[model samples]
Target: MDLDLKCKTPILSYSDDEFKQILEIRGKTLEQLPEDVNIIKEWLKMQPHLPMHPTDRQIVCFLIMNKFSIERTKEKIDANYTIKGLMPELFSKSPLHPDVQKTISLVSCGFMPKLNKKLNRVYVCRLESTDVVLLDGYNYFCSFLEMKTICDFSDSDEYIFDFSYFPMKMVTKFNPMDFKRVLTLVEKVYSNRIAGLHYVNIPSYAEAMINLIISFLKPKIRERVRIHKSLETLGEFFEKDQIPKEFGGTGISLSEICDNMNVLSKEYDEYIKESNNARVDESLRPTKLINDDFLGYHGNFKKLQVD
Candidate 1:
């Protein structure tokens, strides 16, 4: 299936009625898109700390991801820039930096071209080689998330993490502290309200590590995590055809999906370059800001200044 990459809007597969129903469920409508976007634009003008002016489409996406809560949308936008401004190790790099490109070769990860019944985007990630580096993998994910946050339109996302070839010795490959940082950035910065976190083909040795990761999730989200022993079980939530062919579904192969992702990254390269500079100026922040909790640092915003 072709990912409608030519358009500046979401990859259009949903019929108008279905799309409207999804919007209505979130207390939003196509009619309110422009008005709500304008409201956010006006709000941005008042925040001296934030420098970026996002597109109308990005604003609408933030609104949907936040369930149409304008207040939450504003907070998400602020955190999006604030965290990026503070963490150069992850966010400040170019989307297609060498490490990120190397990660594409090391792992197979991509978003499904179509939305699930709940209209949440589906993502599948698999390790291809035991030569996995957590930092590189995260950089790849960050690049992908950044591009999606700006370019794709989706309210929420569900992830299928395939640990098929993952080595048992590296169960501790990703530190718990690093995991927390990544979790906060995705949930707070991009407003990625996760619908489900499904794990398939988990090795016996990795149970403790998986549990540690789950411990970091909010209770509601933790309840949504499922450890699958059988691929058929996933059918309870995802459509049979949409599941990647690697797992017995008739849908697009994960490799092909990654190819689409590569195309997507290229298409948005210029946009990422321009927006990476869009960050919060801590000096101008109107309220008291303490980042003692972000990425495990204890200090005022000025102490952790990245830009």
Candidate 2:
């Protein structure tokens, strides 16, 4: 490892047990990973559009995300950096724009630690604010995931969006275009494997809003969504302590959970700062990469995605 790569603080943190567990999840172990890293590093040197010398830890995570398929891993690395110029909204870094902070206050959100036995990390979001029609949904969702990504690296990501506190009067205030953009970022760029998406406390009045959001998702992702009339069904998927107390689970209140998340916010400030400087230089790319399956529908991806 280069001295600089070794000296830098690791961006992704997990316990020793998790380190072993994640490898086991994919039929891999620590023994052979170094060889894999070296192989990819040689490949990286030939690609001028990306950083040739990221740390071993960074390569391992990207390998895990792509299940160590060499070709897929290369594509994901390209898409990951290609993302910034393609959709900068999702990269909105911290000391967040004032509008992002405002959007956050309106929604109580957190990526909860207590995952199901399925190893699915749940991103819990609730529209906790009132009749205010939000104009900053894009910034809010983008900002939320940016901070959450550093700590939450489960094999599969799940979501529970509580629509109870929301009012029907502001339905039209939502731009499904934000939903479209968010879907694009998560599927085509982040490459986070989504296990499922759950919508709870959705009254009949709020059904259309959920439907509209679902419409923008690709079929594969849309098929993973489930709508619940109330919170009653959550117990089947999560333990009592994993679900929030307000919903009759023993877990702490949503506000408290989100407040605890602030501790991670500062931990991430420097990471996001460093990442913001790592954009892809298309002129250095070896070949033109027009939009394709892995690139999603981003019209700008002609300069992105490897294959």
Candidate 3:
């Protein structure tokens, strides 16, 4: 089997028919939720129907976009780049379900809460560490054997319960591995939302995408090529013996590794260049220090001081 990069292009090309299918599946799940369920009933009564709400579709598409070809996504981002930098402000507090309001308050003052074009309510949060965006249209109201339970703002058991009633067709095409990843992402997002952090910065989105591709291409390769590719990077943490001064790995240094893996490194570089429509050069690679400003620190929260 040709282990090709799955991200040759962004998967933002879903057809209108496919979008309709997505909505139908989403709406089906939304409607099947118990009518007596506090927030569910309220949400359903207020919103129009599936496919009508673009935010939900955008969330789903964003996840799908993560799986798209890096080159393709880069082209799209470059063409309409400004929009990408400004993280979509979907996570808001005011119009939220009381339960959601309380949950998010546990972590943050919350940002950007907008109405879906169809005017449905959905909460969006970005995880800076992971470059992951989370969407929550279903508010957090739980039911026990006999009673209903509203999640407290401080409760941190953030998780994405299976919307089991959703039509199976909606997920039949998704890989099992992807399903697990999506679920984990959703739960993490919920946790962050409640905690009020924008996101957790692991590898930046670019590095993560590159690393994901490397992992996809060579499932067994363990090296972190997803990071900078050079001697300078490796030397910072390692010593002449090629052992990490801090740890024990030989500080042989990344400069040495660059020599050893020049070809593979070039491949990664070329891929990035092609994505951004830039000439293939070391300068174009995404090896700069991670920018902290966009890492989701909403800055100091000081209400105006009235003299």
Per-candidate clashes come to 0, 0, 20
lDDT of 2 by residue, 173-291 (tens): 77676566677767765567888889987878778778878877768888989888788898877778668777668876888766755555555656665565567887788866645
CA lDDT, candidate 3, residue 298 = 23
CA lDDT of each candidate? 0.73, 0.66, 0.25
The local lDDT score (0 to 100) that residue 12 gets in candidate 2 is: 27
| Winning candidate number (lDDT) | 1
Sort every candidate by lDDT, greatest first: 1, 2, 3
Residues 1-307 of candidate 1 have per-residue lDDT tens digits of: 1122223434324455655766788877676777777788898988888877666667777787888888878877777777666665565555476767776777888888877777778889888976766776775677777777566655578999888787875775767766676787788678787989999888888878899889889899999999998677878878976699997787789888888877777787677666666776767877654343442342354464211
Q: Candidate 3's residue-wise lDDT over 1-307, tens digit each? A: 1211111211111233443443354352333322213322233244332112222222223222322223332322221212112212222211233533334333211111121222221222222121111222211111110000011111111111111122333233224343333222233222111211111122332433334433432232333122333333433422334222222234333233223222222333333222223212223323331222222222221221111
- TM-score against truth, every candidate: 0.88, 0.83, 0.17
Error of 2 at 94 (Å): 2.6
